[model samples]
Target: MFTSREGVTLDSIAAPLRRWLLNPVLTVPAALVLSGFATATPNTDSIKFLVPVCALVLAGVLLSLNDYLDKQFANNWVSDNTWNWDEEIVVVTGGSVGIGASICDQLLARNSRTRIVVIDYAPLGWQPKQEETRLSYYQCDLSDSNALRSTCERIRSEVGHPTVLFNNAGLVRGVSIMDGSYGDIEATVRTNLIAPMLLAKEFLPEMVKRDHGHILHTGSLSCVTPPALIADYAATKAGLLALHKALQLELKNIHNAPRVRLTIGIFSFIRTALISGHTNVPNFLLPLLHVDTVGEAMVSAVYSGYGSTIYLPGFNRVASTLRGGPEWFFRILREATANFRINFRGRHEVDSQTGKILKA
Candidate 1:
């Protein structure tokens, strides 16, 4: 019953439902009902357990309804011009590896005439072999305003003012706030949060003048639910979510730049250098997303030309709602989930220069 094209759509239905059923508000009520029934019957453990099962089933139905609505809107209302890569200049930050690299590869493959500009300090191990003339690389630290300004100027000259900008660069110092240094925290904020705002400021005006462009911001699961160890990363991601929302509103409502599409990607853990070591989590609960899948989702969002808050592996929309729960309950759930860790030694080693994990 599943088609390759509809796989992501189906995933969207399943992912949110799983996360919704995990909410304490829903679970607690079910638990209370089960407890009351058990007390009355004295041997109703099986009956009590049905509460969670029923809640999960209900959540699934609701998620399917949402997916149906989304598909209807996407098919009918969304613009398709954003997918015309041939007429667009594509600029991607942190396109050297992982999700960014995958996006670049897919973009290049889509249109040989598309001028693709990759901004990263170093090369990703796997570069696009096709369309060599169409693709160019710029080496600069996006966090530095001076460097970014210079890079933007150079790109403008070489590739023309970019029509599609992907603020996909991100960093994570996989340590607790107590153990992480100030530099580590600052680096995470600078790269993840500040850079996107600055890039938008620099390129958005040109897009508005041209009256056509697409901007995609790569957000994280941490934006919706803050994890324990990566406090700084979480804060930056949350800021990104807010920034994207505000920008979208400003462009659509105030500026009347409806043609300027702003897309936010709310994705979970993917099999990348960033999470190379962590593998203990349940695959059903938190499956490691494929790099290609991440790229395809971004492409689909951009092509659809409808501004969206996309959550990969589907369940992330549920996580966003559960974020409103009491802090104590949320903290307990986060701590329980934090037990996953990667076996760094057993995984492919990442190169210091390129940041690409060597395929074993």
Candidate 2:
């Protein structure tokens, strides 16, 4: 006896109701309901509080199920062979070292025909054996607008438009807000946020026209929980995450361009050249993950062909959920963590001309 309008009404109300049922607020009630079926149990008072918690947990499981379904739908009809390993051309920014370099190495090893173009100001100590042929290098400073534009032009002409664009160039000036110069803030924002936007704007047209492409952005955990000392860096990353989300929605829902995939990686510490100079953080909570692990995770995300946000180490998802708590709570927790220490020993200054770290 259900009319079309009644069915529509039920559908409209279902999502919110489902969400409310999952919230921690209803955990106690849910626990109590389950207790009725049990013959013997612990104190009744405890059972009352436990019910809601169990309900909330169930809600979370259901939500995760929904997300999985959505992701499966997005990747539907795409075979593993759709990746085109033979023709996969990946372009990684700031690829001279760290996680970027690791990614490049993995990609090259997977397919001999896969060409990798690395854009960086300085060179890493080790180079791919096939640099002149399969691997190409471009020395360009991402912060400079003209340099970026020129580099993009050169890349298009030399290597053809990139099938996979990794917007990974970033900087972290350890100086506190009062101690940091305007140049420091400008350089960080320009390189981390602006350059990615410009690169996407310049290259995305070609990708759209081709009807196939992947854009992977390196977002930070700091974007979700901004630290006091690294405000500028955090702000830039937050902007990058926002940009990635907006672009994903535009390409998927509005444009209906299913072939192009956008992914944002949110991660904590990874062992990389960028942090080589810094003292090791405590392994208990904020342990450093291997650069290879991060690289593999990023590449896997790209191949998934679904618009999604990835959090490394699994626990990052829990931390991100707590980011909505009171500001004082976050501040207190951050101060107590090992991340607050100022122990970076690497060269903080870079050569003005080359953008390479200047020797102390």
Candidate 3:
């Protein structure tokens, strides 16, 4: 007879394994190419393929080691065994729709004992039935500093100080640097980068005092290799990468709060309203991810009770080492994809004054 643990389902195990095996992350291709060489006649010409195979193996091992070290180093090599879901207050920004909403749902499903406080300017997409008091919604524009502050204060007085913060809310103008207005640039920066910093300022002190909390930022591949036409959005994402790394350092050195875990999710394009009409041509190496899949990963990272640098689909982790490679190669690769957003339409717009999404 077959059996399983409380949360260990077959899909959970098989799905990740399948994704890893099929990913173009050196291992699968290396195996196939190496096998072809081994089966070929013992000639000098056939042996040339070994060069690429060796490089692939080396790259694969290095990336794997980097991934392991990142997680271990962020957690200070300490395993957290003191997590209590009942007392934790989870905060999700942009929780009204798409991936954010999915995260809110999964968090509730993961543990019925925890409370969730959603901060977004839009109305909650799902209705909570009576007696389901664990979820609360706060309508506030993250781009507006004053509004964000007031809303956080309300959350503190109404629910409690958030022990877990998800900086998932973001906006994109989808225009070239010269084509956008000053307001568009400001709104994008404020929403994408500034808001997360301010939110950290509000809650991080409390987390440090208690020495127990988690902060997860939703980052983008633009941080790794920014494409054309989305300069403002990409710049903010790069800033986010810097902010996350800096916060990790400060949390360890200044605050001395190793238990205050910090995690960042780095992902590519997704099937969300934010990029509804995006004209990105899909390729095997770069696939458009599903919102629920990414949301599940983010929620799982939080439950792990450790800081992590999450790269969804696993294959995109190579982006971490891309800049360190040859400049000519990077330039050629970037130039080839320069027109990625040439046909993409702007799916959303933000109102600078009211801090609400005028068009989405």
lDDT of each: 0.72, 0.71, 0.78
Candidate 3, 252-351: lDDT as tens digits: 8898888899888889787777765433544344656778878988999999998898886444577666778999987876675665654334456666
lDDT for residue 295 in candidate 3, whole number 0-100: 90
Q: Return the lDDT, model 3, position 195.
A: 97
Estimate TM-scores for all models.
0.75, 0.74, 0.80
Candidate 1 lDDT, tens digit per residue, 27-98?
A: 556766776787788775757586666676566567666866765443333354545667788888888887
Q: Which is the leading candidate under lDDT?
A: 3
Q: Which scores better on lDDT, 1 or 2? A: 1
For residues 12-59, write the lDDT of model 2, one tens digit per residue: 344466566664446545565656533265654656655556757777
Error of 3 at 157 (Å): 0.9
Task: Judging by TM-score, tell me the better candidate of 1 and 3.
Answer: 3
Model 2 CA deviation exceeding 4 Å by range: 1-67, 70-81, 129-133, 276-282, 326-328, 337-339, 342-360
Q: Rate residue 292 of model 2 by lDDT.
A: 79
1 or 3, which is superior by lDDT?
Answer: 3
Candidate 3 lDDT score at position 202: 94
Candidate 3 segments whose C-alpha is farther than 4 A from its true place:
1-67, 128-133, 277-282, 339-347, 352-360
